[model samples]
Target: MRKIAIAVSLSIFIAFLIATAFLIHPFGYPPSEMDDYIIENTQSETGANNAVTAVVFDYRGFDTLGEATILFTAVTGVVMLFRAKKKREK
Candidate 1:
């Protein structure tokens, strides 16, 4: 009985996930109005092959720094949690 209930719940969850994915259009890649001019000027002025990388790293470096700090903190927490504790002498 428990197995049947779990199977039914999992099937319903999977169906809901599939339905949601079909309803949402995840691949919409339309360019925004604000980026058009900046991108063109960046490529022309800076001669950067990838405008997106240039904008992300050069224009918004502070935001990237915050993201890196968050990643570092998470890694530190994981290391601390998994570190071997020294055995106490009797």
Candidate 2:
């Protein structure tokens, strides 16, 4: 009974995940006017070929810092969860 319930729940969760992935917009709506202005200005001001890359890696480096921090936290959590317990000897 427990196994059957778990299997049903997992199947439902997987189906929901697939439905959401296909139904939802991944990149979301089009960028706003201000976003376009920034891209244009960044290209002209900085003379960078790829405006988006320049903005992400140079103009908005702080956001990248936050993303790195989140990645580090996730890795730490996984390590802690899988770490072996120390044995106590008499």
Candidate 3:
């Protein structure tokens, strides 16, 4: 009974994932208007020489910060785990 329930749940999850993947846009073909606008305005707006850097650091600053925070948290967690393992060995 439990095994049957687990199998059904796993199948449903796999089907949902496959459906979601199919719904995603094809690679390298993002919405163009925003991309064009960014490319046109990035240097004037942010004074950045490189448009990619301007987008990452200026237009999407908060997103970059969030990613940095996540990376820091992950590194801290790994360090703590290593310390705990070292202590356990003593």
TM-score for candidate 2, please give it.
0.49
Q: Cα RMSD (Å) per model?
A: 4.4, 5.9, 3.1
Q: Tell me how far candidate 2 lies from the true structure as C-alpha RMSD in angstroms.
A: 5.9
lDDT of candidate 3 over 54-77, digit per residue (tens):
989988999999999999999999
Q: TM-scores of all models?
A: 0.53, 0.49, 0.67
Off by over 4 Å in 1: 1-31, 84-90
After best superposition, candidate 3 residue 24: deviation in angstroms? 7.6
Query: For residues 1-90, what per-residue lDDT tens digits would candidate 1 score against the true structure?
Result: 999999999999999999998877566765567687767687776678788887778767798899999999999988776663423322
Off by over 4 Å in 2: 1-31, 85-90
Per-residue lDDT of model 2, residues 1-90, tens digit only: 999999999999999999988877666785478778876788677788888888788888999999999999999988776664323221
Comparing 1 with 2 on TM-score, the higher-scoring candidate is 1
Q: What's each prediction's clash count?
A: 0, 0, 0
Native-to-model Cα distance after best TM-score fit, residue 57 in candidate 3, in Å: 0.7
Best by TM-score: 3
Off by over 4 Å in 3: 1-30
Q: Ranking by lDDT, best first?
A: 3, 2, 1
